[model samples]
Target: MTTDTELKKEIAYNIRAALPKATSYEDYRKLVLALAESGDTTGDKTVSYINYTLLNNRRMKRWDKTLKITDEQMKGIKAFSGKVIWLVLTESWCGDAAHTIPAMNKIAELNPGIDLKILQRDEHPKLMDHFLTNGARSIPKLIMLDANSLEVKGEWGPRPAVAGKMVAHYKKEHGKLTAEFREELQNWYNKDKGQETFNELITLLALENVGNSANL
Candidate 1:
């Protein structure tokens, strides 16, 4: 379990490092509730990510990447000239990354007009330059673009001019997402609840929650 001190420091670092749009306390509340609702009895983090994402949001997984946009989908995206792009830089093992990628898939499901992509941060270090250099290196940045004009519209956190908003909001409202929260979130990632509600959410998010499911 992470200590409160460590959690405080990381939360502070996240505030300093990221720039997210000033989300309504509603957004944070839903996010936290979704995470809390997603936890597993077995104390596993991976299972939690899958369950939380499915229950609360949507996203998809690619071959090696737990959360990604498929090649066939990319081909369809690039074919057009002016399209909005929502790209997330992530890797499956990353804690934040695990949360993010699947969320994108869910977004895609809700709004087919938008386009989504997932890039591995380690594989493409250059991508990090776009969001945040901070070591927090939170995974799964949400990038958006105008589908018709193909201009970038928005993104989630850690970018220049972006971290300020997240900082301003969290400073006033969040009071640091506690270690207990992280612990609970981590718990959701473990074990097999095997509930259909959880599985359906995984499918909507395009997440491979069941590695065994892939075998079939």
Candidate 2:
């Protein structure tokens, strides 16, 4: 079996190569528009779906301006005395990515120790396969690693806890992730105001401190 450390080293190697080629959020915004205007059927309806996700992300980013962390979250961030890398697997068209990434960006901005990098999910199949949610290739999955050792500290993703449960309940009742369910999910994000996502991440990051015996 590939040990966890070995797997993370592989993931870090892939990330180093992909970071240079990965598109920025602005660049991805342009690509989504270009894909929509191309009039090509190469990806069929995927282009249209991505276009919708891009637009939704724009809205979420704007609304994410009010993201604020609690005192506890600040303390958790402060406990990290070493540099950490936040390597995230995402795509421009993932609805969950649209809703969650802006707040993540904000969190990274709060701490100089945290360096954030985004890579497209489809482009990193093996890495994505390792972080599957319910055996699905879920987007917006994130892995936290030690900058020096490249050890995987913890991971979180796809959606915040409350929103994830909402999705589960919706899928259970509706039999699929339909448009109605998606709209409801976004609505929940709007009301939550990124609190759940931020809280979850702070908790995840705190685990890293506990592992290192940092004063928390």
Candidate 3:
């Protein structure tokens, strides 16, 4: 039987192997846009997934255009001096990834110490397994690592705190997330304007503070 520590070591090994093949956020965005334009998707290229890819392309564009970070948040982002890589697992058709990844890119943009990388979830099943949320392969999972050491520092994912809570409560009540609830979640993401995601990411960075004393 694999102990937790051994499992983590194995996962880290897998992460190292996957990193070289990971795409930059810019490249991932380009791929997504091309797929949307060509009526295709990254994984399990079903018609519905293709449609979702198309829809998510527009969502990402909107987020890229409209997502705003407050000055304080920017300060928090800039205070971090430790070099790190944010390896994100995602698929083009994931609605949450569409909304949150752009915000992540914006955060990475503000800090030279941070490098953001993307991996297609289906393409890296073994890597995805280690970061599974609730025994399921929930995506847009950000795995933060020490760039030099490749040590896992922390993670943030699938949804923001509030959104995760909402999902949990809804799932508890209904046993599954419905299409209507998904629509509601998208509306929530739109109204929130990526603020929730930004705030949580700022918190994650603070928690991983190496020697930085800056308060968020």
Per-prediction TM-score to the true structure, in the order listed: 0.37, 0.81, 0.95
- Candidate 2, after superposition: displacement of residue 125 in Å? 1.1
Query: What does candidate 2's lDDT look like per residue over 148-207, in tens digits?
Result: 776677888889988888888888987888877778787887788788888888778777
The sequence of per-residue lDDT tens digits that candidate 1 reaches over residues 39-61 is: 52112357654564444333222
Q: Give candidate 3 regions above 4 Å deviation.
A: 210-216
Candidate 3, overall lDDT? 0.92
- Kindly report which residue pairs in candidate 3 clash with one another: none
Q: Pick the candidate with the highest lDDT.
A: 3
State how far residue 57 of model 3 sits from its true place (Å). Answer: 0.4
Best by TM-score: 3
TM-score of 3: 0.95
lDDT tens string, model 3, 1-216?
A: 999999988998999899999999899989999999999999998998999999999999888888889999989998887788999999999999999999999999999999999999998999999888999999899999989889888999999989899999999999999999999999999899999999999888888884345533
Rank order (by TM-score, best first): 3, 2, 1
Summed over model 1, clashes come to 23
Off by over 4 Å in 2: 1-47, 214-216
TM-score, predicted candidate 1 vs. hidden true structure: 0.37
